[model samples]
Every structure is written in C-alpha cells, then in structure tokens.
Target: MTEPPRTVQSYIDQTPAWPDGTPTDFIPMTAMQWRIWLLAPAGKFFEGLVVFMTGVALPLIVKDFGLSPAEKGIVSAAPLAGIMVGALALGGLADIYGRHRMFVIEMVVFALFLTGLTWSPTYLWLVVYLFGVGLALGCDYPTAHLVISESIASKDRGKLVLSAFAFQAIGALVRTVVGFLILANLPRSGRGAGYMPPRSCRPSCWSWAGSRSATAGIG
Candidate 1:
C-alpha cells in the first residue's frame, strides 16, 4: 500500500535546504562610517576645552578684574545661572526640533560667543558672552545624550556616551596645558610682589622657583 502524502507543513519541517540556503543582504560599514561617529565627540572636545579654561582661569580672572571675592563668586555664578536657563529653554527646543539640527546651531552659537569671551572689554560683556555659553552648554549635553541613544547600536550606546564624556577629559587636559603656558608667559603680581619670569622654565619648575609669576592668568 502507498504511504499517505506528506503535507506542506511536514515538508517544511523536514527540509533543511531552505534554512541553509536562504539569501540575505547586509552592507558592511566602512572606515568612514566609523569616523563619522567620532565627529560629535570631537566637537564636544572643543566645547569642553572652553568650559575647562573658564574654570581654571577663574581665580586669576577675579584678580585681573579687581573683583572682591564675593563679586568674583557672582561672576562665576553667572555661567551656571545662564546654563540653567539655557537648559530649560534650549532643551525644550531640542525636543521639539530635530536633535542634529538643533545641535549644530547650538554649537555655532556657542563657539561664536566663546570667542567673544576672549575679547570681552568689560564685566557686562563677559556676562553677555557667558549667557550664550550657558545656552550652548544646555543644548549640547542633552543633544549629545540623545544622539548617542539614536545613532549607536543598542549594545554600543553606553560606549558612545562614554566616549563623549572622554572628550571632556581631553578638554580638561587641553585647558590645563593652555593655562600653564599662558601663566608661564604672562606677567602677574601677588603677596605684595610682582612675579614675572623668563619664558624658559616649565610650569612645574617655575611654580617652585616662584616669584608669584604668571599664576594661571588665562581668564
């Protein structure tokens, strides 16, 4: 007697051919694609550098401006206050607009204002510059976080975010180097004496050999 016919489902279950021979397509990523991922952090590194310098130079800045310590505190507070307001305002905009576009705009605005800080002629001008810095600071933090979540793969998201933070470290390093260089070269006075030295000795050696010397005056 003939065996009963095998059903389609039975054939499917029995067949290893289709499973083994299935065709699929996945485009391999290029080196350029990988590099593109780093561009964001590179942008962030510059931002970090600016923020770092501002902090490192604060004491010297207070002296330069002849500000009372309390006034110095207020000047320092300005950026934080601006950042908070910026976060409230720009964060909302970033959420409403696309993060990428908003981030670009924020970065350009920040860079411009940060340059202004270098040339600000008065305390008011400096505060004005920092207001823009606050706005940029607010937008960048959330925007970078959002970009990492959206751009990287699920397993890699944590690493990308860490990479962005790593740039902050890099920025801090850059600012430290810059502050030291400036102090080594610039003139300053303290403790009832002027401290100006030749530009030959390194920061470590100079600090020890001291005459107050250009003590971290970048602000």
Candidate 2:
C-alpha cells in the first residue's frame, strides 16, 4: 500500500544536519544581533537627514551667507564629494581594523562636525564642517552595513539590511515635514523670523540625531 504524503514539518524534522554539519534546529535572533540591526537603520536615517537638510536650508543659507551662485553650488556639493572620499578611504580602514571601532569613531566625528555647524563664522567654515560630516557619514555606510551583516543570521540578513536603508526615506520625509511646520508657525514679518528658524533648527536637529547615532554604537 502507498504511504501518506510527508508534510513540510516532517521533512524538516527528518533532516539531520545543516550543510555546515551543525544540527538543523531553529535559531532565533540574539539580543545583541537585534541591537546591531536596529542601530544600522538609525545611522542610515541620519545619513539621509543631513543630505536633505542641506537642500531644505539652502535658501536661508544663501540669504545668511550672501553666497554667489557659484559658491552656493560648491557648498551644496561639498558633502557629496566628501562622502565619496570617505567611502573609498575609510571603508578600507574599517575592513582592516574592525567595524565596531570604526563605527563608534565615525559616529563621534559626525556628531562633532555637525555640532560645528552651529558656530560656523563664515561660509568657508560651514563648508568645511559639512564636508567633515560627510566624511564621517561615508565611513558609517560600510561600517554599519558590515556590523549588521555580520551580527544577524543568514536567513534574515538581506531583509534587515534592506529595512535599514528604508529609514533613509523616513529621514527625508521627517526633514520635509519639520521644515514645513517650523516655517508655517513663524511670523510672516518679524525681527527674528526667517533668520533663526532654519539656522537654529538645522544644527540642533543635526546634532541631536548625530549624537543618537553615536550613542547607538555603544550598544
């Protein structure tokens, strides 16, 4: 007589070992792995936040700095340029040294440079600080990716990495909405109206978010 068809669970139960010769028992994500996974997305969020804030604050920056069109273009492109340099250079360093150390160091640098924006005395200074921010951010990309990929189980690796990138979109959206809300509430014509809003808000927001990314490295 023909035997009953085996169920999926029966097949799994019958399997003796993984390809690596380990037992085929189900393994769950560990606490440390989850922390690493969540931290990666926080880094991506700030990466997107800093990039979008440049555009959002551009008009105010132009007004404040009296930037020529050519100067404005350079200031806007500085972060992207720095990012390229950082990715090429620091990415290799992370691989050689270690991802966790690089991640913590880079996040601290990112926060420090972002905070420097609050006190920039000239357009050149602002550009320099922004470039530094980009450098740190560039280091973060590979380091964060490496940390998360190494920490998580193979089955969920791709999904978690993709989810981390999704936070970039979320960060962009938050910047837009916050900028709109701040603009809407300001008086149309007042002493400190347009001047303080973007200038004050951007640095504070950047510093706060950057610090959070830095602290996440400790977890």
Candidate 3:
C-alpha cells in the first residue's frame, strides 16, 4: 500500500517558521495544472487578430491610395510614433487604473482608429489614424504581457510569456498572406498599368468591386 502524504499544516507546525520569511527559488505545478496553463494566455487571441488584420491591410492601403515609398514609410511610422507615446503615457496610466480597464480603453481606441483608417482621405489623415493605432498597440503590449504573467502560476510564467509572444509571429505570417492576396486582387492601375495585361487577377477583381461599392457608397 502507498503511504499517505503528510498535511502541509502539520509540516509547517513542525518547522521553524521565520518571522522574516526566507524566500525560496522554487515553485511547482502538476501535469494537469500545466495543461490548464496552455489556455491562460488566450486573451492574446483578440490582440493577435487585430494586429494581423492591421498588418495585412497596410500594404493594401498603400496600393489603393497610390502612395509614394516615402509616404508609405511615413504612414507606417505613424503607428510606431503612437506606440512610443502610448508606452510612455498609457503604460503608466494603466499601471494606476488597472489592467482590465486599460485593456478595454485600448481596444476601443484601436477600433476607432481602424474605422478611421478605412475612411481616411489624405495621407496626413491616415498617418493621424495610425498614430492612434500605435498608441493602442503600445498600451496592449505591456498590459497583455503583465496580465498573462500575473494570472499564470510562477512555474508556468515562462510558458505563458513565450506563448503570448509566439502569437506575434503567427499574426505576422497571417498578415503577410493576406497582404499578398489583397495586392493580387487589387487593380494594377499604376505606372505599370499597361505592362501587365489585366485578365482579371484576383486582387484586381476585388479592388474593382470595392471601388464600385465606394463610388456607390453602399454603407
């Protein structure tokens, strides 16, 4: 027969309980606990999805608007600028107001900026929109990191952080594929318009449809 395990209360009672506790390095979790850990960072799903969509649509925006490379760089940099500001500003506020509240605020701001992006008329307007997006992204990055870290057990921290970060890579790949698809479909009505004979490339067809809808303004 297997021996029964001693209760922790009994064990603690027997030991020397230091008034100023000696901090230990080790933490432990069971196999089942470890398995449950796999789901703890699922909040990243929403964050990852948003990031993937933004990255995917960026190239399409450049193509549709016929922006110069400098403009593309500037537009792309706007979000980055927002990120820097958001990290410095929102990060501290998030720490003060709590993670959940900041998360909600961040997501709302992201949605607003994304909607704005769809309607942006001028390059400057798009850049301004992207600036907000960057700020939201900055707020989310640390907030999500901290949330996943604090929620998971010490033993599972490594796995949780790694899993959350790994989602970034997945998001990037998804964005890349979507970008290629969008570009492939959009009308190639640029300087090279006559070079490639248009035989209804997939992206071009979608772009044509999109243009017609834009002209019609069908909500």
Candidate 4:
C-alpha cells in the first residue's frame, strides 16, 4: 500500500544550534562536533567487528565449549536475541531518558560487556556477555544517527554520517585480516606450524572458512 505524505517533526525541522550560538549550516566543525562525528559510528564498527569476529572464532568457541549442534545454534543466536530486546526496550529508554545520555551509557555498557567476554570462563557466561554487548550495540545503533544529525552542521551531515557508517565495513575488513593472519601464522596447539600456508591465502575466503584455520576454513 502507498503511504501517506510525510512531514518532518517541527523540532527536527529546526536546525541545530551550537553552544556558542553559531548558525547550523555553514560553520566549521567544532571539537565536540568532530568528536561526535568520529565516535558515533563506533556502534556500527563494533557491530561489524563482533558479528564477523564471532563467525571467525566460532570453531574455537565450539571446540572449547564442546557445544553440540543445538547448543551451537543457541550460542550463535544469543547476541541477536539481546539486540532484539535492546531495540524494543532501550529504544524507548533513549526517548524517555535522553538520546545523548543513552548514547554514552551504551558505549560504557558495550565496553564493560566486551571486556567481560574476553574472560568468560564458561559457555553460559559467554552467552551472557555476548547478550550484554549486543544490548548496548542495539541501543546505540539508532542513537548514532540522532546524535550525529543533531550535533552536526546540516551541510556536513550527509558526508559525515555516510563515512561513519562505513566504519562497519572497515571493522569487518580489519577483523577478517587479523583472523586470517592469526590462523595462518599461529600454532594450532603449540606443537606444529600454522593452519594454512601464506601462499594459499585469499582475502575473500573468510566468510565461510573464517572459523577454522583461515585457509583451512575456506572452500
């Protein structure tokens, strides 16, 4: 069905006003604005990093946890469930509480949970940490745009937001390269050589083969 005509919110229609009472459209970026522009996309960047890094690490995770197929499925879906819950619950929290406030809170939560994930001692703990991380990321995912557009000059909004969004891709790319390097270079069990020879490498192969030895994991 076709939608009704759209209208911008009256508040949204009003341009941003900086603290120094500068006009919104044509001014240079302030230090705070630059900070926002640089940091806002961290949500996307971490989202991509977590998703791709999880896939890359799944084999080791499964092996370490002795997870069966069903359990593996649960492991894979836990973060997603947290994202769903965060989107439903935290989104409104931002609206009710405050966007910028929640944006900062979410990252603090994200960092806490991410650090917790590294030291997770059991499968259940791992799932919990992942869920927490997902929750923070989910809340911030939408907040990033609100924080950016409201803080930035209108002339630079499109360019800054798009570049910020690309952090997701950059994060994924960085993880893929890191994963591949570790796989092809590190010892399997402190015994023999690495998983695959460097000559056999391909940058594009990580999506499927990422969980195992980078080269071995690929088709």
* C-alpha root-mean-square deviation, each candidate: 11.6, 8.5, 10.2, 10.3
Q: Return the TM-score for each candidate structure.
A: 0.68, 0.75, 0.62, 0.71
Total clashes in model 2, counting residue pairs 3 or more apart in sequence or in different chains: 0
| lDDT tens digits by residue: candidate 3, 1-219 | 998997643442333334688655544444754544444333344334444455555555565567899987787678768878887777776688997787667767776675665567677877887687677777777787776665556555676688777755664564466555555655555686522324444333323323332232222
How many clashes show up per model?
1, 0, 6, 1
What local distance difference test score does each model get? Answer: 0.60, 0.72, 0.59, 0.70
Give the clashing residue pairs of candidate 3, or none: 184-203, 185-202, 185-203, 185-204, 186-203, 186-204
Put the candidates in TM-score order, highest first.
2, 4, 1, 3
lDDT minimum window of 10 residues, candidate 3: 210-219
- Our tally of clashes for model 4 stands at 1
lDDT for model 2, on a 0 to 1 scale? 0.72
Best by TM-score: 2
lDDT of 1 by residue, 1-219 (tens): 999997643432332334668643422334653664665565456555656566766755564556777777776777667677877777768678887788778777766776566656577776777677766776676776776666554445567677787876887787788768766665654443544443453332222211121121111
Question: Candidate 1, clashing residue pairs?
Answer: 195-213
lDDT of 1: 0.60
* Top candidate, metric lDDT: 2
Candidate 1, run of 10 with poorest lDDT: 209-218
